[model samples]
Target: MFKKNKRISLLNYWTSRYLLTLFVGLAIISFISAAWIRHTTFQNRLEMMEFLADETVYRLTDTSGQNIGPMGSIPGFIGNRDRFTMREIDPILYVVDTEGNIVSSNRPAPPGSAKNVANLLDGEEGTKKITVTNEGQESVQYVVKKKLENNNKVVGWVLVLEKKENLTRVNQAYGQLALLIGALAVLGWCAIYSLSKRLAHPIKQVAEAAKQVQEGNYTFDLPQNNKEEEIYELVTSFKEMANKLEQLEKTRTELLAGVTHELKTPVTSISGLLQAVKDGVVRGQDASEFIQMALVETTKMKTMVGDLLAFNQFAVDAIPVKVENINVNQLIRDAVAQWEVMQDDETVKIQMDFLVKSVDVQADVVRTQQIVTNLLTNAKQAMQGGIVTITLMEKEDAVLINVSDTGRGIAQEEQAFIFERFYRGENKKYAVRGLGLGLSLSKMMAQSIGGDLRLIDSNSSGTCFEITLKKATTL
Candidate 1:
């Protein structure tokens, strides 16, 4: 037979946990309240008994060592029904002499009650409860005895007896009250469980979405129209995280395809050129030119591979830079000069517009040089014979360098993703064949040195890349 298994939800779990603690706490309070009520009733009964016994002593004798009427007449006045009625059950009274002889009695004395009184008269005052059974019904009675004195000398005794049923009735009342409180507690727990269900509803949605996410599902809905701020924020954050993860997955797929295609072209070129030279199909001068071409392609491949490795390090924050104060203008000039020397096409003119003769900045010299080299190379490669302007100036508390090229600008749609890893724009003139990590890596390098690199402007006229570095403090 197939059996149904019940699933315990978040609400059930929280309810059980909360109610367990509440049950224990309320049980303790009920126990303490019951105990205190019983104790107070017992104390009140004992005090009343003592008060009645004292009144009897006063009525029996005056201060001049003389009886009011006779010794036997004491009980008649002490046991009078009109005088005291603090308890529903009346107490039994007995008057005795100092030598343990009974002088007056309210009722026929039971042997146990008399023995206890005799013990009390004979200096035995420690005993508190005395059990008396009458007509096959057993009951507990509190014993209270007071010394009767005249002229500060012991004359006789007055013993008062009250039943324990009065305190028992009080205890029964408290028990009823405790039952009512327990009912209220049950209602309160029900309310709490309902509230917990409401609270766990949104949380449950998020948990289910996350489970789906673990299984490679990133598309889901989280309603945020009408909800508490905290809950809204939680749902919003989870949605944003899912979107980011989806985008990252797409980027990874693109990178794999792009990297493969980029690497294959140069490798295929070099292989074809070498194969041609090896087979002796090409002559000496042409073979030498083919070899040079292969070398250039290999160099391009090396540069792409290096960029990939450096980007990986930058992603993990593992690339360390030696930070120091350096002359910004000189660094830019040196990078441009080196780039110009590497270029075979002298048709591309390089122009410098230095608004400041010397601009100092805090940066890692080598990495800063790398950033400048990337920009210069990008500008040179983007154009066939146009001017590449390198402008350096001071902007408030920072040094700014703008690299502009008179080539086809990056597409408006692709502008947002230009600095994204493995992202390539479709600008035909500016589309250099390589892994698109240079701008991303350059941006990371700039940020690592407490500086920034960004696309200032890119239009049909030209494209401009700006670099900002904090000014070095003068000692």
Candidate 2:
């Protein structure tokens, strides 16, 4: 079993981390933008108030034809005038002369603003300026001052009182908006968490499956994910690998049992025969025959062990093929000829059908011969006495060699598993004398040489097995 990590899982960590970053960034931006809007509204309000006051003073002086002086009732003229039409920030106008006495007033100043006015009059101030005065908890006011000058000498001042109502309204609206955005951010955090969990679900399943596999539980099923290509591929590949492992484990168990049976039969026979001879259970000639039979059994056991080793070599890719272009037709002919000399069944007839002569393919000569020999042997063993036919032909970009037998065909249920190692069918009436490794070994060798071996047809008539090899273009 794999050691579990003690830290937080990736899903939780990233979900919380990213959501925090998102809301924090939104908060910072909102703060800056709201502050900027309030400040901008305040400045613009001051400018508008200054413009209105200047315009009013200009009209009074123009109407009087330069006769209006600082002593005149300026407040009466200005107060009787209609109100200005500015919306963003409304203001009250206050005017004072060089002696600091109020010259005119459109509206009374908010308390505590008179000191600000006096400070302005006492200084050698510039012609135009704006300042802020806080009236404790009652209100805030922005003051715009315009110095009225006659030939650069201070005559009086135009004071504009722009209250903070518009600015305050804008800030209140921004506060509400901020609340709404914060609410959305909370909802977004939930969404992010769900998305992270959805993404992590499949990964967690795979991890659990892997742990089960490590504990030798190959039957565990992994959840499938078809939408994500990379994840799907990973899951499919792991399934295939697990299936292979399961099959190999089963084959190993069967191999051990089959090997034990095969070895024990021969060893027991030899041991019994030798014991019988030593006990004088047979005469000298019979004893000699028993000894010869024992030698044959030993030889057969040796061959079985050798076959097991060869199959193991194929499994481990230890058998290197020296590949070269060769005439496949000639190879098949030579293999058939060798089998013909070895067959002692007089009732069996062999036929050869070569559709295209001189067909060439890239193959290892020895492994190719071995493949043909194994197939022919299997065909011959399938029947007590029947016809075995070898056919060779060319396919598009490939070559095909089929070995067919005229005998009782392999069972339909067993065809799929015929090439699996040690997979013996129940049909034991004409069982051949060997472990069921010949077909499996032949199939592996064919694949090693970039070829394939498969049952083309199997029925009451016969069974035909086809071999496909890569065609050599150079030849």
Candidate 3:
């Protein structure tokens, strides 16, 4: 398998290449091997003939004036003459003399053969060559020879006829071995390529899955039935991760749907209630009730519109920042003062613990207050009949704040999507007077000012929203 950064790569280029290389390599090897074997056999046979040539030269000298062994009678005159032949290896061997007197007894012809070495007994020695026949009736050629000499003196000449049939057998054997080796090499190459392709198959699956995901098809299923358990494990983990992301996406879309319906409810209600009041269908105190209902609906509309607009503003590329240093404790107190005025809370309690003295941070004051205000409002809504705790602290290089609510805690599955725009929990409804953009906008705003907002902890102990900001630089 091939991979980069632990992700499988899709490329595979070895399949065709290995097969071709194997074929070429085998062909070259076989060609070399065949040539070597043939050369070795030819050299061994030729060496044996050369050794026999030395013995034949000795016999020509030792026999002196008469013929003996494989040679015919030596001549004392000079001119062209016929030679004698005997069957030895294949076609036969020839013996020609200085004067070319080929004796019948020295070079014996096959039984009942017509030639008796009679015409070859006396002929020319200065003619430089000689010829002999094996089956004279059939005119079958036996051997031909030219004069050979070592120095100024003339030495005997040799002519050995080779059968065409023996050569054909050697050629056939070499060809067969070469073909067999070639076949084996082809089969081996096929096996290697098949193995490489099979091993690389898992990578193909991973690549395909990635492509499907890119195309917005998140429901891709990995091949778990693969024999390699490690690949199966990798695919299983990928599927699980993708499924979780898909579910979180679905939740966010659901939240957006809820926000849209929430806005529509208020706009529709206000349009109806105000229309009745304006038309005088309700009079005096009844008219006032209708107006109040319309007011309540208008307030809900304002909250939804505000949250959405604020979230969108952070997402834009426009730069409208005006950063400055300010005491975070004072900043929170001022924000809480506005929230306190919005709702009278004699029945409920709100508290601020300024643990740090003069905790300062560098920020765009308006956006920083928006973040603090959003967290405070969210806590306030949750703790309708309970207590809300807000804290500000100064660390070494940053200021931190935490807001805690004694109301309903966030669910585990919903926590991951909490900072995504328009993502709300399952328990949330269109009547909640929130567009689900507050936390999302707050997180984005904090990040823009070199800060972050995150859930510190959430459970039955209540949810905590933690904020971190860079400590304000001292002059």
Candidate 4:
């Protein structure tokens, strides 16, 4: 079996990685800085020694090669056995003649120190490293030399010798640098930790909110006000989504009840009427009337069932549409005339306005007629008596057919959901019995035929819906 990798919180994830990177970077910097500090310190010490050698030669001799005083009487000179503890380094000095003889000295030289004088040519002056073994222990030393001259001719040499052990003590500066680097690393880690926590806090809250939503609890507290722009947008968008899902959940429950009630009503009525006739509770004429009523209920039930099936088919794009070019003006007029004959109320008037005499569009004739008939029915039902107008206009490769009605218009809030499946408006939910699929189905049909249906305007004055159809290329 393969093991699943464990998940970690965002805070830990970011902080851990940042901490590792910070330390690695600091370590590399410290190493380079330490090496540079040690090298510079050694170079500075060598330069100081060279300066001392030059000064000693100047003080010990005049322009002509001759000693002004004994080396022990010179200022800043220490005896061979004198021990000084206040200075960082104490180098031994020796004055040697051009014949390689020791002329004056500050301290007795260690063994093998005089070998460097013999290696020097007549007036040569420079610094060199030499390893000297004293009392069975090996140690390195720096030897700096300056030429002693009389009238520009070489007379002797002044040498300053410093042990390598003394120069290695320069690491104290490296230690201080390491301390500063350590402090900065601590500060950096603290800043990174705090920032990671701030970023992870809001994300955790969102995750918790999502979990609650998954468990069907849509109401929960979230970090509403965030300073970060992206975090603010995420929280805001998630809140909106949760609210929409809640509304959909509530609508789903209501639709289920409505469907049950709508389907059961006719079934109950038919069953009761048939039982009454079978039990012979009325005479021949009464029996005929009850049977007619049962048949009417049966027909109503069948129509509702058919609407549900057709809607399901259309939703999945399973229904085929036949598209053809037809005269849009004539189509609307014919559809309105046929719908008018079926209405029981004569007070409801439908007025047609055509901007053009003849305009052809590519659309399914039956579906187009069905959309018009549905709009007329909704407009007529919206009020007791009102004018329902159908306006036709042509604009840039398309035809627009607007159906408007002067009714108690739709409620401002309810207007947004008119075309949602099984969504009945509050005003019509109880007064009118329907599954609320008329507009929804009509929209689906319109889109199926390379057309579209949308609400243009609605208020207390009236409501208008527009249907857009593709215009035929020719005739």
Candidate 5:
């Protein structure tokens, strides 16, 4: 019957809350504006009263230079029977001898101060705004009083009595205006809620669809068909994610087949080499050659196993580094030396520049060396037996260890997911073969030690990997 008003629904709740706030806010503003206008009108009335009070002054004195009109008329109530019309409302007029005596009142003054009202003109007068309260009543009145003058000396006052009823009427008028303002505010809020719900409905649908998409359903589409730029971008990003998922599925299938093939090659070689030896088909030289062939196959098997271990570690990754102060320059040199041992001097060259004075870094030395070694290996992998330059320096609060190579660098297409597991780069001439775990392990190791590794520069010359770490200043 009444929409149940269960105190919640996006529309009902938000609109209700907004309406409450709007009503309070508009009520205050409307009350203030209405009150101000009423007050300004009241003040104008006072100014008019002031003007009238100032103008009405006549003298009453005796033979020493006294005029007698004060005896004939009482201030602005010049005629004895003059009736007050609302058009000219102002000071009440009265006159008496210097001795207090009742003379005239436009209306009978309130009884409480009737006597005082009769004689108030006798005193010296300036314009005095006075409040009158009677003995047993709560209602009050304002009297604006000015002196009646005899040749510029005040002989009497012209007094005006305005009742509390007039102020009550002004307040009632303001109250009515406030009610109207409240109604208008409620109506305005309803309109806003209706319009905003229409505008926001599409967004809510998109949000639900996005959640569904995140949970592996890429079949969702935004219902909004208009040119809303942000929603359009959202839809585009979702479509992109869907496409990426499709490509990943295809890559996953290919990887499975490739890995099986890779495994079979080594297994087949090992089985054949062992069987040949067992069948006594070889003598001294042949046996040794077959034995080396089996050993190489076993080595490839070991490499594949290591890649699987690194992949598993990445999945549940551990940051098992004991932080200690180590010489940054020395660590780089050591990793470079290891690579130098693995290659002939004529085959490839290693260059080093230690930029800073001796500085210590909080790092796991083994992992740090591994990261540098992996980057150098990768740099060598991309080149034709060229020079790999490694640098270490302190920058402000961080230590930057850089490895740059001069070789055929990574393709722009391949650089993005270079850190992802099993992302083996394309190699030519079969020299740069790997199970594709080196960069991923290095990245994980770098992050574990509160550091980061990133490719800062690359072009026709090989890519540079910058490993940034907080300099261990105290150690």
Candidate 6:
């Protein structure tokens, strides 16, 4: 098995990666800068040496090579002496003849150095630059040579030699560059760390909040004043989800209690009535009535159980729906007529308004009839006596079946949840005996047949529900 990777906080992850990148990038830049600085410094020093060599030759040639001494300085050449002094360069000066013999000197040099200088004299009469390491000291030196001329004739040479380390100030330049790079690196790390912390803080809080929510704690505080738009949206959406889950949890608890009470009531009634009859508490006609009451309770319980099972099957898409073309007007009329016959109360009247004489729709016949009957039953239960109107209208490749009732409409607050399973409105919770699955089941059945059932309107005046089905195409 592979080893699992260790988890890390966002702050550490981002900060470490950014810092590594920053340092690596800075390192590359520093390397380039240092290389360039070293080259430039050496070039500038070489130019200075050339200038000194030319100046020395100009002074010596003016005297016609006569006033030069062993020290290689013009005895009265104040300007030349000051130029060398101002530049602070201590270089060995030499005058070599055309025969490659040393003529004058700035200071006493080793025999090896004098031989190296002689070997460099190639009889050329123009200025030339060279780099060579002294054998005695084993240190590199920069040498510049200029020809000494008199009356436009070749005379000798003036050579100025300075140690390479003394000519170039690369170390000082590197020191300053290192300081600047360090400061920038420190500042960059601070900015990256601060920004990363700010971004990671909100995400950590959200993770913690999610853990709390998993533990059944829906209430928690989160940063609402985040300046980032995406972070603010994340926090806002999570809060809304938690609130919705909390509402669903409360509804679930209520539904469980309601289910227990609804099922237990009928069972208790049946048991009591049967026990009464079995104990010989009633006899003859009374005993028979008592037994009948028990059977009625038993039937009610069985109906409730059947509804629960059907709802579960429909929810899981386990029930098959056979859709076919049928005359919607006739189907509604027949369902209303059958439902009317079953209702014992005559005051509740149902009327049909057929806007189209004949309309064919693709739907499941049994499910359609069941949805209409369920709506009628709910309408009857909503009022003592009222008119339930069923209207059929055809429009734009679809047919609409509207079931309206002139009864007490659903309350404003409860209308949104009428189609939720096991959700009974406050007004009907105590007055009605049901599992609150009628509208929910009807909607599921309607949708399974490629149609929809929805509440179009509900108010204090009345309520209206519309069922939409696809119209059959004529070949």
Query: Which of candidates 1 and 6 reaches a greater lDDT?
Result: 6
TM-score of each: 0.63, 0.60, 0.55, 0.67, 0.74, 0.62
Candidate topping TM-score: 5
Task: Write the residue-wise lDDT of candidate 3 on 222-338 in tens digits.
Answer: 777877787788788888778766876676667657766788888899999988888889889999998899998898788778667766777993546677888877877887777
Quote the lDDT for 400 in model 1. Answer: 87
Q: So what's the TM-score on candidate 1? A: 0.63
Clashing pairs in 2: none
Best-to-worst order by TM-score is 5, 4, 1, 6, 2, 3
- In model 2, which range of ten residues has the least summed lDDT? 122-131
RMSD of 3: 12.1
lDDT of each: 0.79, 0.76, 0.65, 0.83, 0.68, 0.83
Q: Clashing residue pairs, candidate 4?
A: none
- Model 6, residue pairs in steric clash: none
TM-score of 4: 0.67
Model 6 regions lying over 4 Å from their true place:
1-18, 39-82, 85-131, 136-169, 211-215, 266-303, 314-317, 320-421, 425-428, 431-433, 436-475
Angstrom error at residue 413, model 1: 11
For candidate 5, the lDDT comes to 0.68
State how far residue 460 of model 6 sits from its true place (Å). Answer: 8.3
**True-vs-predicted CA distance for residue 178, candidate 3, Å:** 17
lDDT tens digits, residue span 96-162, model 5: 4354454556555556565667545546554444455467555555556665556655545566556
Better of 2 and 3 by lDDT: 2
